[model samples]
Target: MKIAFVANTCWNIYNFRKGLVHHFLSKGDEVIVLAPKDEYTDRIKSWGVKWLDTPLEGTSVNPFREFKYLLRIYSIFKSERPALALTYTIKPNIYSSLVSKWTPTKVICNVSGLGTIFLTTGLIGKLALILYRQAFKFSSYVFFQNSDDRELFTSKIKVESYKIGLIPGSGINLEQFKPLAFTQNTKTKFLMISRLIIEKGVREYAEAAKAFKDDKNVAFTLVGKFDTNHSRSIDEKELKQWITNGWIQYQPHSDNISNIIESHDVIVLPSYREGTPRTLLEGAAHARPLLASDVPGCREVVKNGYNGFLFEPLNSSSLINKMKLFLSLSIDEKKHLANNSRELVEKNFDEKLVVDAYEEAIHRIIKVS
Candidate 1:
């Protein structure tokens, strides 16, 4: 059987769905990927699957461009006619499922998060909800990363309850992210890894870091690339100002994330919302404590005061308080938090669980077809 995985970027599919893709390929199923070409595109193609470049403008709302995107997806579905299509991100989930209605393919949409659209009250939000409802009507299944998202979609968009399923946000690979030895350093290190975007709480993180600027024993590091294309992106000027102020140490995005996570004592994410953040899961897998906003996807990973702390979203003072609390912890207490982080990932967010879920869904689709 042939299966297709579609998303906005090859980077997303490569990082999040590679395990599932490998699972199907190992079982003798032909796997194809449809996403925009990026540095990871060649890497994914090297896995012995066909790669088709499907250009997408993620944040654009122009009707003509959207129509062109839809037509491109329709053409792909009509030509390739895969047995099953698993889609991620907003555009692929919405457009691919809509195309599936007229094609021989069956689509399974993954609702990673509500994103900015569902968070606001506007005409665009209403129109997006309508599109989701119509597109999901043709989808074979819709998997949500968190229960909060599932409830919201069901309540607001009225998707069929029978078609809804919940899975951990692109489960973490435990073997790949083995816990590192805990070493007490002279300085306590705190790190936040995310795109430099306002919605991700970059400003909050910087402000919180400022509170610790005078402390010689504390260090704060921010790792991620500046996304100039995103509307919510933090501009280079703001980032430079933060660096000049010596609030936090900034590092450009690195492919060696595990190495960076191992070096940090604690991981922090102050984002307003998320669809299961991979960084938190990766941090936990490395036996690093977490400090994140008490938002939906983050709360599911951080059991406040267990594996880590949860602060108020978008509140710099709240984040500063949490950092102070962490700084006050004894070495043993810090180690306990780190241990619990690894234990939580083992119990709930192993990559095997995600692979199994996808395999089961694939089997059901094949049987039906």
Candidate 2:
């Protein structure tokens, strides 16, 4: 079978779903990637899969740009003629679903997250819902990372009930993200891994860090890219200010990010929303306790007072309070919570389970075809 994956960017495929692609290839299926080429394009090719560059105007609300992206993807779909087409993220799921409806190939769309458009009330939000309702009409299966997103799509946009299925966000690899020893030594390091954007709670983390900077034993670190999509992105000026003020240590994004996870004592993400946060799963798989917002995606992974704690969305004081709780945990207590985190991930968010779910969905579609 030939499988084609349509996502927003090559980076998304490389960072989040490489394991899924490899799983497909190992099963002797021809895998093709249809998305915008990036620095990771060559790396995908190295996996012996075909990479088709489809230009996408990400975060653009212009109808003309959307039409162009649809045309480009439609051309690619017609040419590739794969047995199945899997789409992820917002634009690809909407456009690819519409394009594949006329083709003989089966289409599966993953609604990774609702994103800011759906969360914010405006003309754009209404337009996005309309597109989603229309696009999902013909999809074989629309996989949601969380039940809340599924509920929102059905309740808000009123998509057909039979079209949706639930899966934990791109599952974590148990072996790759093995449990790390949490040696609560002299100083405790807290890590927040996410794109530096307002929606991601980057500002909240920074604020909490500032509030806790006086405590010599507590240190904060941030790992992520500067998101240019949102207005609240930590611009160079602000990031430099925080760094100079010694609020938190900042690290740029990278593909090989395992070492960074291993180096931290705890993980925190104050995201306003998420699909299934890959970083949170990674931290949990590494058996590191977490601090995240009490939002849909984050809440699904973290059971408050168990493996991790959840703060009110966008509340810096709540985030600070949670960080202090983490700070107060003794070495043995931290270790116990860390172990619980690994157990939760192994049972619920294993990468193998995610791959199996996708494969099963594909097989079911093929049987019907």
Candidate 3:
């Protein structure tokens, strides 16, 4: 069987969905990635998967560029005609599904996150909603990361409820992310891992970092790509100035995500919204307490005082308060939060569950093929 996984970036496929890709390959199915090549493209291809660099102007408003993206997707699908297609992010999901009806491929779309477009009702938002309705009409199944997203699509896109499935946000491998024995670090470090985008609350994080610059017990670190082309990206000069003033230690994006989490006492993501934050799941798997916004995806991860804390979505002051509270925790309380985080992951977010569900779905398509 030939299976194609599509996303906006190869890094997304490499980071979030690699476990599922490996599962299919282990069963003797050929896996191919359809996305724009990035630093991780060659690395993922080295795993014996094929790569096709399908480019789209990520934040462009030009219709000509979008039409070109559609044609490129259709050309690829018409040629390869994979047994199945799994698409994440907006453009891939929409364009791939639009072409699936003309090809033999069965389409499954994962609505990872709604993104900033849905947060407003501007012209672009209206256009996106129209495109989604047309594209999703061709999808064999639509998997949403959360129930909120499913409901929104049902009401807005008018897609049938039966066509929608709920999967945990790109599940975490329990065995691989097994908790290391709890060790106390001399300085309590808080790490925020995400794209340097305003929607991820990068601005709020920076503000919080600035407020706590004088604290001796707390240290803040940030790790993720600085996407200059993104509409919501933090200004390069501003980000550099933050690091220069000793507000936050910045690390270049690296493949060693597990090690980075291990070194930090707590993991934070102040995202404005999420499908289900993979960061929180990974952090919990490492027995690190989580601090995140109380939005749909994030609140599900942190159990208030049980495992970690949650603050108002865009409130830097609220974020600062939570940081102070974390810093004031007793050693025993901190230990309990770490244990609770790991326990929550084991009970809920295990990667095996997600893999099993997808494999079953794919097998159904294979039988008829």
Candidate 4:
């Protein structure tokens, strides 16, 4: 059987779906990837899978460009004709599924998150919803990262309930992100890792960090790529201002995320929403306590005062309060939170669970076909 994984970027498929791809390859299934070429394209090709460059500009809404993208995917399906097509991100899920309606290929769409499209009430949002409903009508299955997303789609879209499923984000590799021995740092280190975007609460994080700027006992670190291309991306000038104000230290995105997580005492995500953030999962797997917004995907992982604490989404004051509360904990109390973090990931969010779900879905679809 041939399986093709499609997404906006080669990097996304390489990092998030590598386990599932490896699972199929180990089972002697031919696996191919369709995504825009990036630094990770060659790396994915090295894994003994075919890599097809499919140009997809995620933020572009130009009708002509979108039509071309659709035609390109249609051509790929017509030629490759894989038994199963797994798609992630907005464009792939909507466009590839549309193409699958006329092709022999069967598509499984992964709704990682609604993103900015669903956050607005504008024409774009309504159009996106309509597109989703039409594309999903042809999909073999639609996998959501959180229950809230599933409920939203089922309520607003006309897709059948049986065609929907829930998956734990992309799942985390426990062994690779195992808990390290905790050591008390001179200052309580709080780390936030995400694209520097407005919807991600980058501004809120900076404000919270600014609140404790005069104190030497608390330190904040921000790590992520400066995504100037994103509509909601934080301005480089503002980021520089925050750094100049001595509120937080900034680091460019790094491949050594595990080591970076280990160096911090707590992981924080102030995003307005999520589809099960991989950062929180990685932090939990490393036995680092979490501080995240009380949104659907986040609340699923963070049991308030259990493994971590939750704050009001987009509320800097609430984040500050939680940070202060965490800082007030004794060494033993802090360690307890850390231990619970690791325990939670062990009980759930293992990478194998995601691989198993995809494998089962593929087998079921194949059996039906």
lDDT by residue (235-303, candidate 2, tens digit) is 778888899999999888866677888888888999999889998999999899988999989998998
- Highest-scoring model, TM-score: 4
Error of 1 at 177 (Å): 0.7
User: Scored by Cα lDDT, where does model 2 land?
Assistant: 0.85
RMSD, model 1, all Cα superposed? 1.4
Residues 326-359 of candidate 4: C-alpha lDDT, one tens digit per residue? 9999989889999999999888899998988887
Which ranking of candidates, highest TM-score first? 4, 1, 2, 3
Instruction: List all candidate RMSDs to the true structure.
Output: 1.4, 1.6, 1.6, 1.3
How far does residue 64 in candidate 1 sit from its true spot (Å)? 1.9
Q: How many clashing residue pairs appear in each of the predictions shown?
A: 0, 0, 0, 0
Instruction: Find the 10 residues in a row with the least total lDDT in model 2.
Output: 156-165
lDDT of each: 0.89, 0.85, 0.86, 0.89
- Note the residue pairs that clash in candidate 2: none
Deviation of model 3 at 312, angstroms? 1.1
What are the per-residue Cα lDDT tens digits for candidate 1 across 163-250?
7778898999898899987779999999999989888899999998888899999988999989888777898999998899898899
Model 2: residues >4 Å from true position, as ranges? Answer: 229-232
- Candidate 3, 290-322: lDDT as tens digits: 999998788878899989999999999999899
User: CA lDDT of 348 in candidate 3?
Assistant: 79
Order by lDDT, highest first: 4, 1, 3, 2
All candidates' TM-scores? 0.97, 0.96, 0.95, 0.98
